[model samples]
Every structure is written in structure tokens, then in C-alpha cells.
Target: MSLLIVGATGTLGRQIARRALDEGHQVRCLVRSSKRAAFLKEWGAQLVPGDLCDPASLPPALEGVTAIIDAATARPTDSLSIRQVDWQGKVALIQAAKAAGVERFIFLSILDAEKYPQVPLMEIKRCTELFLAESGLNYTILRPCGFMQGLIGQYAVPILDKQAVWVTQQSAPIAYMDTQDVAKFAVRALSVPETEKNSFPIVGTKAWTAEEIIRLCERLSGQEAKVTRLPMNLLRTARRVARFFQWGWNLADRLAFAEVLATDKPLNASMETVYPVFGLNPEETTTLEAYLQDYFSRILKKLKELDYQATKTKNQKKKTSLRF
Candidate 1:
């Protein structure tokens, strides 16, 4: 079957593409840029360039497409809110798919989209999910836990620099999923012939409190890693500052802080729901110690690369000024 993966270059989306390609499935990916599409094509994905917000650009991309995996993520700083992408964009994609005679719509969602009210991101997810349920199309929804990758972004410097990660008391007990695992489950959801219409929450192996995670890091990395529990007040103020500078910062920060941090994490969200369905179990479960060691190592390498690039750029600019 020809599968169309929207947002094919994103963290979750790219992994899904990789899994699908490994299964010998013909994968077509919708990318926003020619550069990205060229890169994905080089990696063996059939790349179709299109924008999610513009409906007029979709039909050609959807032509002869059999299924869609909507991995599109809305940034809080986006001019359009989640309603635009999660709700309207999803609806448009579904409508276009149905119009094009495509069969299935698989959505990548978050756990507790409906039950959670403290975060706008969840609220938007809930809305899109509700719309998908009522829509007259074959659908499967997958809600994954917080990603280990979410912690790997360049901004995670504070945690890396100190050889420790700070957290509020809420994230004391945290359970997050590896992005690779989430992608595996998404591929299964797409490949499985059964039309299961239930929302499944995918999680990783273990949940560790911030302190426990730090202890693991210290043990694994052979470094003195400390877990500094910051006051809620400081976190909130930081969030406010982020919001002042960015549009989606308020919602994004609130969601991360209120929803994931201040909560009890359970294994229920992990591969338990999906193991039997996918006929696959996680063989490599990353322990807090192992995960941190690898995570820190990667960040250190990236920092070195970035510093080298910046120095090169600065030197080139200085040479240009000297020539003038």
C-alpha cells in the first residue's frame, strides 16, 4: 500500500518513515521544503512537497495515496493556534483523503488529550481527536508519552552543563518514551490490517524520579550528577519570560510544567497496550543511567560541532572585513 507520511521530517515522523521503509512498504512523505524532500528522497522515501495549512496544495500530493500518518506538530509560536493545524489541518487532510478515496487515517496524539485540561496543547489534541472520532473515515489514534528526544533539544544545556537535570517536585516521578519506540508503534498501527478504532497510549520501559534519574546518571557516566529540585516559583517565572519572547511559549511551558512534571507517571502508557497488537516487544529498554550517559555524550559532541562551526563563521567574517 502507498502510505503518505505528513510532517515526514519531524522527530516522530522521520522515525515512522524509517520503520515503514524497513518493512518494505512504499512510503511517500509530505515535506514543506524541496531541500528536506531531497534529503528524505535520498534516504529512499518518496518525497512530495506540500504545506499542511494550504488545502489547495494537498490534492496533488494525495493523488493515488492509500493512507496517511499525521505526525504534524504545531508550535505554540505559530501564527495559527493548534485549532488551525490539529483541528482544521487534520480535518482538511481527512476530507481530502476521503475525497481522494484513501482508506485509513492514523493520527499521532498525546496521552490524556481529553482528560487533561491544564495544557492547551492537550486540549487541542483532544479537540482534533474528537473530530477524528466523529469523522466518517477509518481511523487509528496513537497517543505517546513524553519523548526522550524532548530532553535532547539544544536548550537542554542547563542539565548537560551541570552533569545534572533540574526538575520540579512534580517530575520527581517521570515516565517518558523513546522516540524510536513511538515510531515503531506508529508503523505497526499503519501496517496492521485490523481497523482498530481505539486510542492507544505508548510508553517506554521505566519511570524514574528526577533524583533517581540523576543517581543513575552518576553511576553510569562516572560523574557527579546532581538533581536540583527547583522551586515552582522560579520555573513559573522562567515560563513567563519565555512567553514574553515567544507566542507559544506560555502554552508549551505550561503543558510541560503542569502536565508532565506535576504528575504521577505509570507504566500503563508504555508498550503494554501495543506489545501484543504489534507482535513486538521492546528488547532494548534504556535505563536511566544508560540513557543519560548516551544523552550527555551526544550533547557534548553537538556542542563541540556547533562551537567549531561558529568559530569558522566568525573567522570567515573577519577575513571578509579585512579584505574590505
Candidate 2:
């Protein structure tokens, strides 16, 4: 079957494409620039030029495709409005999907998006979920709490580099699942009849707080983290400043997610109902500890190798100078 993956170059979307390709499915990626997504093409995915912001460019991309997995979200640094891509553009994509007679529509939404209607990105996701549900198309909505891939840059690399790791009033515990695991469900959803028209919350095995993550990184990297805790008022003021400019709307929408930090609740859900339907094993899921350990091991090993090479070169230079 031919699978069209939206946001094929994104963190989650790329994993979905990889998994689908590995399963021997014909994979087509809806991308804005084939030049940038050339790596995916090398990985055996067909790239179709398309943009979520451009309604006219969607239908052609969906032609002859069996299903769609939309893992696309507007980035904080994006030039376009989140609403334009997440809501309006998605609406156009859905309408076009229905018109194209695509078999399944898999949507990746944020957990508890409905609770934060004030947050532009979350609200857009919540609305898009509702739209997909009522669109009369065979659909599966996967609400993932967060992605662990974000931690490498957010905490791990920064700790290794001795940079400031930012935190906040941080009350919410998040079960940040690996994007690869989430991708498995998205790819399997197309073949599973039971998953049609259903929504499931996909999260990590355990939830973690900011302090816990910082400590984990410190232990793994054997380095004390430089922690920087920003006040809620400061973030709010920054968000307000961001809203004043058209280019800043993306950052403003993303900063609104800080509301999660103030909430008492954890952004997580039980997989008891989720894994069975997808025919996936919970034990096989990647844990936060294992993920971090692997990252640190590979990185530390590379650093040690580089240091050895440098020391060897310095010693050789000294021996030659002393002989001369």
C-alpha cells in the first residue's frame, strides 16, 4: 500500500516514514522542498512537493495514496502562523483526503490539548482532532505527551557542553515517549481495523519532572548541570512581547505551552488500552533511562577517542623535537 506521510522531515514524521519503509510499504512524503528532504528520498521514500500552507498543492500529493499520517506541526521558529498550518491548512488537507478517497487518516495530537484552549498550538490541535472525528473518514488520532528526542538538545548535549539547562516552576510530570515508538503505532494504525475512528494516548513507561531529568543527565554525563530557572512572569512578558510582531507569533504560541509547568497534573495516560489495539509490546518501549544512557555512552566514547588522538599527536611532536 502507498502511504503518504505529511511532515516527512519532522521528528515524528521521519520516524513514521522510516518504519513504514522498513515494513516494505511504498512511502511518499509530502514535502515543501525535495532538496531539503533529499535524505528521505535516499532512504527510499518518494518525495512529492507540497505545503500545508498551500491548499492548491495538497490534492496532487494525495493522488494514488492509500493512507496519510500527518505528523506535521508548526515550529517555534517557523515564519508562518501556527493556525495557518495546523488548523486551516489541515482542514484543507482533510477535505482533499476525503476527496481523494484515502483509506485512513492518522493524526498526531498533543495530550490534553483541549484543556489549554488559550494556547494557540494546543487549541489548534484540539480543534483539528474534532474536525477529523467528524470528517466521516476512517481516522486514528494519537495523542502523545512529548518526544524524548527533544531531550538530547534540551538537557543532554547542554549538560555535556556545560551550558545552562533551563527549568521553570515545573510541576507537571511528562511521560515523554520516543518518537520511534509513536511511529510504530502510526504505521500500524493503517492496517488495523479496530483502530479506525479511535483515539489513543501514547506516552512513556514513566513520567518525569524537570529536576528529575536534570539529575538523570548529570548522573549519566558525570557533570554538574548549570540550572537556570526562569520565572513564570518572565515567560509571560516574553510571550507578550512576541505577540507584538507577526514573525513572533510562532514563538508566542510555543511559549504558551509553559502553562503545562504550572499545572498540578501529569501529562500522561495508561497504555493498557493503547498497546493491545496496536499489537505492540509495552516491555519493548524505550525507557527514559535507557535512552539517555545510550546517548551518553556513544557521545562519551567519541569524545574519548578524539582526546586520545590529540594526545598521541602531541606526544609524537615532543619526541621528534627532543630527537632533533
Q: 223 in model 1: Cα distance from truth in Å? A: 1.7
Q: TM-score for all predictions?
A: 0.79, 0.99
For candidate 2, list the clashing residue pairs, or say none: none
**lDDT digits (tens) for residues 1-324 of candidate 2:** 999999989999999999999999999999998898999999999999999888899989998998999999888888988998899989999999999999899999999899988888888999999999999999999999889999999999889999998888765899999999999999999999999999999899999998999999999999999999988899999999999999999899889889877786899898998888889999999999999999999999999999999999999999999999
The prediction achieving the highest lDDT against the true structure is 2
Regions of model 2 farther than 4 Å from truth? none
Model 1 lDDT tens row, 21-93? 8888789998778785676787788888777788988999999998888999776556665666766787788
Clashes of each: 4, 0
Which pairs clash (backbone N, Cα, C closer than 3 Å) in model 1? 76-248, 170-261, 172-209, 203-270
In model 2, where is the ten-residue run with the lowest total lDDT? 163-172
Displacement of the residue 98 alpha carbon in candidate 1, Å = 2.2
Best by TM-score: 2
